[model samples]
Target: MKKIGIYISGLGQSVHQESIEKYAMRIKNELSYNDTGIQYDIKSEKIFYTQDRESTVVSIFKSKNDSEQELVYKLYDFQYHEILTTKFKTKNLLVKNLILFGLIIKKLPQIFLRIFASGGFDRPYLTFYAFTLLLLISLAIIFLIPVSIETASQLNFSVTIPEDIRSILENVKSYINHFLPISCIFAKIKEWLVPVTTFILLVIPESKTLITSLATEFACVDKYIGNGEQSQLILGNLDLLIEYIAENEPDSKIHYHCYSFGTIIAMDLLFPIGNIPSTNVRNRSALLITIGTPHEFINAYYPRFYNNRSPIMEASLTWFNVYSVADALATNFRKDMNRGPAEFGIKDVLLLPENINYEITSDKKMNIFNFFSMNSIRMHKCYWDTSPNGQSCIRLLFQKMKQQDFI
Candidate 1:
């Protein structure tokens, strides 16, 4: 049987193709004990389509023994939304998107809930989107069809209208999307809106879904997670697994290997709207291995969002959270709270000091910001790489995957 290994990247720089390769290398070598070169063929980039701005890269892996069997590794990074926001700050595209994003985020749960209730968001749903887009656009223009004809007839072309008057009318017509030009501001907004909305949905957090399920978790409002679709793409793609579980298929198997903010996104995906209502959905994923998870930050600082959010979803599913004392990104509080796995349905928790005793050197930036400079960031970033201590987080996770029969 083949396996699906999905990686959800944490917050920060986007997970480049190399990062995916290295992470897969850890899984391949640590589990299969093979160092076959792993590479990526980017499935999507810039996510500039529909304004998704996320970058998705996938790696195909075949089992060493069974050529017919393999694992497909996917990295869904919603970093592009943030990238767009940060890179084009003058564009103010990010904040400009809040309304569009908010509306989409609000409606998504109803869409998803309807899907699961009816079976799943499969082929029909996709087809619906296409037809719906066309139908909606057509409806918007329905009233204009006759009006356009009327305007055309009223236009006194035989009267030789002044050029400036014609130009103003042309611009007005363009504003109404009559005959759009590339340079028009309305044209730009129209052009960018879909893409921005696409990007926002691609990385929109499940917190909206969470609030949908447990309305009181918010006490007042919903907190949608992620500034980008790295999470949304992952979640949308993850719908496949969720569908499998909803159907209660016998062969469905999936797992999440998430890092940093990626872990938070994974949390929203797994427990969107709080605890899963169905065992099929809860047990669909074999396990969740979180690296440098910041669950503690959410749980403590943002307790409202964390109130009903759980690291573990079911008694049967294995949830392994990998954190290190030195990694600035990982947290210890969530692990401490989930000390009793059975209580929370979590199988196990790990606090790795992968680089604990490793020596740190500070060359020191000669600048004033040196006040904030430290080597811990170095340790956090390099946890994937082998250190003198001979323990890497990736390697540790590979071992766990095997032990848990996730491989």
Candidate 2:
């Protein structure tokens, strides 16, 4: 029998330990295949375990043994080397070099064109143009030069958007739209230019700095929903959980199962700093399972731009996204009942009951009625139920982990 430790977060630290113990026991009973004892530990972080203790520990870090750790480090170095080599050969670098060469060739043409256009060969203007051309070439070369994949992956692309400030901007736009006469030429120009200028500013790197300042200003707004802050908090907790598992059980591997916000946090950790660590230590124990996660939300928010790839997609990791039609949060759950499986990238498995109105509330009550009733018709509520569907889903998740040789 393997000793498994399960860690759960999201629930605050004020939660009673007795409740956690009971929950752990129930989970253990549900997943029991033998005399496996699953221990549950609740902290202000997220972790999950099963009946296989040794495997769990190994999943947390690269290796328990010194030889394996050394090998992992060496493998990481090799991957970095590969990234550098590949980057040097990329089309972007070639294009940049070609552009610089083209600029050099056109130097005389530019000078002649300027001289003819301005009625003289002005040395100062020619020098300015030359300098400008050099500056452009230099910038192109610098940006086009490919760095190691490890280094590229470590780049931060996240931008924080404050709701209150956005609201203020919206209000200003609205006021401008309403009170400012659209028929007036100046007003029309302002309307067109405002959005264009905003778009251009956002494209600039300095926008991130401005956003940070704005976010600080709106920090005290009571109605503000700090999704970015929440994301960071969840990410921090995940890192802590991973570090804990790595420290406590060096030989075991870590597998993750997540739902909603939990899924987002999992992605953040797996794809930290825009790079997925290709080391065996990182990949060995990496199996991700996401439930009811809005992976498409980022795309939806941005429209026609699929910028946010799930960490599962970025890394060489095995993943399963479980979704149900009965969950309101699942994409298009209310529109087409059969669409859930397809939307979630899981076509074969249907976890929700057919034709069940997830929005409807039932009169039947129990001790845990509040928990289940909160989202009565939604698939999210199904997790709280001790039904076979939920049980099977949990069991199958672990079973898949085992099949991946994680156990």
Give all TM-scores, in the order shown: 0.46, 0.38
Q: Local error of candidate 2 at 37, Å?
A: 14
Give the best candidate by lDDT.
1
Q: Provide the lowest-lDDT 10-residue window in model 1.
A: 213-222
Per-residue CA lDDT of model 2 for 83-166, tens digit only, reads 112322343534435544444454445444544453221222323333343333334333322222222333454645466754
Clashes of each: 15, 13
Alpha-carbon lDDT, every model: 0.43, 0.36
Candidate topping TM-score: 1
lDDT of 2: 0.36
Candidate 1: where are CA atoms >4 Å away? 14-19, 31-250, 274-280, 310-312, 334-371, 386-391
Across 260-339, the per-residue lDDT of candidate 1 in tens digits comes to 66676666766664545345446556666677665543332233454454444554456676655444434544323222
